[model samples]
Target: MMITSYADSALSLLPPVVAIVLAVVTRKVLLSLGLGIIAGVILLTDFSFTGAASHLVSTVTSLVWDDGALNAWNLQIIGFLVVLGVITALITVSGSARAFADWAHQRIRNKRDAKLMTMFLGCVVFIDDYFNSIVVGSIARPITDRYHISRAKLAYLLDSTAAPVCVISPVSSWGAYIIALIGGILTAHGFADTGHLSVFLQMVPMNFYAIFALLLLLCVAIFGLDIGPMRQHERNAQKGELFDESKGLPPGATADLPEADTGKIMGLFLPIFVLVAATIYFMVSTGADALAGEGLPFSVLGAFENTEVSESLFYGSLVGLVVTIALTMQQKISTSMMFTGIKVGAKSMLPAIYILLFAWTIASVIGELETGKYMASLATGNIPFALLPAVLFLLAGLTAFSTGTSWGTFGIMLPIAADMAMGSDSTMMLPMLAAVLSGAVFGDHCSPISDTTILSSTGASCHHLDHVMTQLPYAIIVAVISIVGYTVLGFSGSVAMGFITCSVLFVLAILGLKIATK
Candidate 1:
């Protein structure tokens, strides 16, 4: 049955609002998302119970098998997650994690150093947010654990860095996607002479939220600036509690993995190096193949624009898994123990996989409801030109927060923002576009159903809600600062002034938090 869109109606907002409220209240992500999906289907089916049931089944089936074939992108991401889990398990069982921890302990003497290292690693792995989210956590977790850093804090560092870094980096998957969109938007607006890359580069400086968020992360790491629930988590960690025991281990984490005494640091470091190297190689290779298929010449930027990120991640992770297995064998781990690691690792990812599946399904339902479209529509008409950047930022943030997909929010809001800018003052285009990018990342950081948010918690072995609750205050602080920055830019027409204002405000905010907390 074909479902009609509720995009023109206020009811379009109901599903996501329900989902967000329930997720917060119940602290059951899957249940919240399931009900949200059902709620959307009911609205689409005019409250027919049987119709809602059938629609739900069809919607889920379509996620796995779309357009008469398997949904390769979704499946590949799932494959990568499982493979990464196995790699993590293998390293733990082989004692590579312990060895790496011992090595790190020698160098990283305090929580501050451990956090700064995690932030540094996160910035270094800016190729893709998903890869960064998990890989950085896998490598840095041992060090942070050794320093008694709370899992929530580690997850915050990972989550805050992942999207903020990706959204701003020119060579990253997020950048490629956004540049492609901007190219089309520019041409459509009769700015065919303007280079898309140039516009993207200029906009990078104007992306207040992303820059401020990263700076705030640095301040938190350097100054031990913990506020809100995060401070409690940090206090608990100092008392030898890294997480709430009642919440259980995070998905894709196992507490009982046997650590071998003979584990070497190379066992961990080698596999991770291979993972990053192989993934970058595959990303470029696949991108080049795509360029060739399109009868276009190869360039690094072009390859990135054409690359299949999920496919590259899957292949790279598979290679990493093979290397990990070989290293485990060399360490003389028992065959039975290795097999147990495989089983445990694969099984551990199920909860996360389930949550992701539900999140995707609800996202799809919300799409059908035209939730983002409705939200984006609100930003249209009769707006003062100076306030355009700040308005777009808020709208994009709301759309992404409701949908739980920054990319989806980008798709929905970028064209609308472009049209608005073209219709008004073309001079405000780059700043407006930058605001959309910044807001999407900010919103994704706060969203419980966001994939990066989920993976960050999994990577740090923290309860998903614990990560969400702890990170909310920090995200809000950055977002508020971003809004003020954009407002200043809009009124002053100076990107530098706006950024300087944001920076000053951010420093003051950090200092204020430190003093208040003290």
Candidate 2:
């Protein structure tokens, strides 16, 4: 129902490719993304400098007041990030996180246990990736540092769980978004009875990358399978050196304020527990109403299907922030001190906010350029049916990597995935859909410009480039396994056997890597 200004052409790929290349080469993430936006604007304006400048102004301005900025989903997510930042700051300044670290110090005794504990925390916060990365990094850094765990390792743990876990969780923000996208496509194609949530559940078993990534993370954590740059980083960490001095730590690393040791772990435990409970409550109640409004009988799963994930997350984060502030106040902290913490916390999110704006704007520009449609074209024609899922996986991975945005890649590829499967056997549909999801997350997991990657670095206080470099080898290993798994599934046409085959292979791969690294 939207009009695209540009015809589907090869030029649509240039903007994101330039952005990716520049980010990798320059190591200036913000600058690289900004240049990509400019390139996209120039392309959209027919290659006129004056036109591009004018269009850039209009587009950037509109993000503040119109489509990108005024969008309800966008606002909800933005509010959640700001409030989450404030809550993180409040806990840090109030010494709540420090108290929790002290409380955990006894339970998590060794370096391996510390890493495992961080991984557990990451898995627990599956409601939203943004929330997961920020909360886990903020809370676990002190604990990890106490055990000589490197910032790179912490970033990997944070990044690995943030997106991969959300993509698989049935009630998380990511699940809601994917359901909405897939539902719309299915409804349009006359599959009105094919519930999107049902399809999502079916695809969960086939989500190879997400499943394998978590398994691999567990292997790395429990077995200490440090390889490539991560091994060097871990070696440095054991010597009480967390980061390479030449690269320097990220700005605002001071967010981990010095602890006062009040020993009130409630400051940390209460806020997080409340955040999870509140988010679940909002998702259920909001989703219940949405389903009832449509006159559908409200099953528990149906309620989640209709929930407003972003709005619920915003409310949940806001409530959590309020509770954390009140807890800090009870510690006899001055009003000015609490407000100062809020300001510092909000300011900390500015870098992430900046990248998100440019990323969203570039995605909008790509949509207008019909980039997805152009890529979809490549999947058409007489291709071998047995290799379709594998091919689509690589294509989706490349698209997500180039753009540094998984949601954008999903939006672009999901329809094509569905359409291709529609022409063939219906059994292929879920695998194809799963492939798109897996591939998008795989690419996002590795991309330096990805918002989750940036947040992971910010949370862990690791250099952004170090996180990407260390995580890439791990991500690639899982990606290769997924590609082969999907290819075999496509040919065999057996989801159950495919699941067993991939699961066994994933385990074997992890064990092999663990031994190899040792």
Best by TM-score: 1
TM-score for each model:
0.98, 0.91
Residue 228 in model 1: lDDT? 87
After superposing candidate 1 on the true structure, give the runs of residues whose Cα lies further than 4 Å from its correct spot: none
| CA displacement after TM-score superposition, residue 187 of candidate 2 (Å) | 4.7
lDDT of 1 by residue, 1-518 (tens): 35575654689788888888999999988888888888999998888899889989899998889989999999999999899989999999999999999998888888899999999999999999999989999999989988889999999999999999999898999999999999999998898899888889988889998888898999899989889899999999988888988877788686798889999999999999999999999999999999999899999999999899999999999999999999999988999889888988888888888988988988888888888888898898788888888989998999899889999999999999888878877888888889999999988998887888998988887888899999999999999999999999999988898899898898889879889778
lDDT per residue for candidate 2 within 1-518, as digits (tens), equals 12435547898887778777897799777788888888888888887899889878877776657743466777787787788778877888888777777788889899889988899999988877877887788789879988989999999999999999999887777887888888898897789898778888888989999988998999899888998999999999999988776755463365434444463888988997898789889988998999889999887667776788778889998889889978887888777777788888887767667777777777777767777668767888688999998889888887777667788889889998888888887768889999999999998998776778878887887877789999999999999888888888998997776667778888888779868887
Off by over 4 Å in 2: 1-7, 67-72, 184-196, 244-252, 255-258, 292-300, 335-340
**Each candidate: what lDDT?**
0.90, 0.82
- Worst 10-residue lDDT window for candidate 1 reads 1-10
Superposed on all Cα atoms, model 2 deviates from the true structure by an RMSD in Å of 2.8
- Candidate with the greatest lDDT versus the true structure: 1
* Candidate 2: pairs in clash: none
**What is the TM-score of candidate 1?**
0.98
